[model samples]
Target: MKQLVRFFIIGMLVSGVLLYLISSLNQSQGYTGGNTLTIFNWGDYIDEELITQFEAETGIKIVYETFDSNEAMMTKIEQGGTSYDIAVPSEYMIDKMRQEDLLIPLDHDKLPNLKNIDERFLDLPFDPDNIYSVPYFWGTVGITYNAELLPDKTFTSWNDLWDPDLKNEIILIDGAREIIGMGLNSLGYSLNDTNKAHLQEAFDKLGTLTPNIKAIVGDENKLLMQNNEAAVAVLWSGDAADIMWENEAIDYVIPEEGSNLWFDNIVIPKTAKNIEAAHAFINFMLDAKVAAQNTEYVAYSTPNQAALQYMDPEMVADERFYPPPALTEKLEVYQNLGKRNLAYYNDLFLAFKMYGK
Candidate 1:
């Protein structure tokens, strides 16, 4: 009986020690009993080195994936084939996701860095009061052209692309939203235009421009323009910076009638397994120094006001990255048009794709 009692005592002591070690490790890693969180973001959206730092500090594994289009990202999430913890989608898709009940409202109290964001971006129509998402980067879609090549072209407006002389020399963005939005804006209609007549008119205009188009590529439209495969292309300001960095021949211009300005936000999904860890990662990125580094590397704008103080004064003054207030006045952020309107958009967009092809 004494021998059995000794064995029981030893086993209890061993179990206690093991449990204590496990608890200690968990506390150190902030692993409060949950699965690792998965993140879906655009390529080059965040600095990988920074991400590694976050993972090392928090002990939460972030499974990162990339998609070029918001539609493609939404499709993956909606299919339910894989689980994701966080997704970085632009202004429009965020609204759609919220409407579909695919996103959960965020707890702002958990995110002290929320204060770092500019008040202008907060409480917008999409995710009003900044409840669903935290703004990551914001930019405008505009024309980036080989200015040297088009010295005599005098490109200043969206209509300049339709010049008969430039036929077969222009590259267009392959994404439906951007291409269609351009046509709508050119015709004095909303980017979220739902009227059948307005859409048909835009589609016809696009069809005319399609035949003369050199190619349809996206995100990389600026690259094509820089390589002189095409003289002009519709591209994001960040992509324009990439092109200019590679080949200084190109310059971007916000169309006189204006273009779409968009914000990409970070959000913790309802499926996020490590909520606290996610918040910690977000807060770290929002830190002024970290945010400024990200802005310089990514060639994008941070909505973080504090980060602006850390940015290079020259970059801040650059019209290409930070268009003057007068230029921004002409641009608009798209709102969530209802499902019926989206269906209209899809149908018209598909038609344009088919006809253009």
Candidate 2:
């Protein structure tokens, strides 16, 4: 009977040890189903192969989604109570997110690979001191012209879009800020101007271009340009670059008066579910080698000076990718205009469409 009692005790102890090991294994496996990192970004902006490669290297699954505009993205995130690990948004929108208290402060120390970034692109007014975001790609909005379509004409300034020759042959950027800003730039006014007269003048200027414009577009400029539906368009540098590959006749030019210098950055929202993984992803992309590859593939400017050294000289030398030093000096980065100004800007755009037509 004592021997039987000893056997029962030993079996119970062994079962307890097994139960403990099972519990530990379950905990180590992480929350219930599995771990997935969700990324929200603009469409066609990253290399899928690179994402796959990142997943393979890190053992983290990447689930990516895209939105066409910052407002839409913000709304969805707010409404859905969405939990995303990382997101890429443009400069002004970053300020909006920050203002809304929708973003989390980044721990730069967690991103050692940030050393690859050029100091010049760091510490902008939007994310001063580089505390909230990391720039992933940089570009300027510029005029993309088909040299074959208008060989005789020289296009130099935003005013050139008003040329009668471009009538029904040009495309304007769809965003009110860009279209109005172009007009404002042409009129020697600040792009962020809130004064009624200045905005009216911008509206008038855009009205003049409207008769000439074939379409107002969001992201279809490259396709339209490639197919010859658009002879000239104001386009993002990367989009222009991608189309230029298939059609060498296309050329990109920054308006002589100057244009906006913009950067899209990786930011972790306050609602992020996986902060550590987000940092890991940012650090991974910030690697000079990785940045070089991404910049080359996406045909965008790198904010990474160290990455530039590792990039092909052809990419570095592409005038569209890296404008002349003098042009760079004249360029301005956009800041988030306050809410009242935003309402005014929207009103101006509506007026343009309603009466300027």
State the lDDT at 76 in candidate 1.
83
Q: In order, what lDDT does every prediction score?
A: 0.80, 0.84
C-alpha TM-scores of all predictions: 0.82, 0.85
Error of 2 at 234 (Å): 1.5
Provide the clash count, candidate 2. 0
- lDDT for predicted candidate 2 compared with the true structure: 0.84
Worst 10 residues of 1 by lDDT: 29-38
Winning candidate number (TM-score): 2
Tens digits of per-residue lDDT for model 2 on 1-357?
Answer: 999999999999999999999878766754233466789988877878889889889887777899888788888766757887898988988898888888889998899988878887899999998889999999998899999988997788888888887778888777778878888889988777778899888887788777787877777877899988779989878778888988999998988787889999999987788898889899999988888888777877889888888889977887767888888876788767878888888888877767544
**Model 1, span 222-291: residue lDDT tens:** 6567678888888877777788888887888888888888899987665566677677777888888889
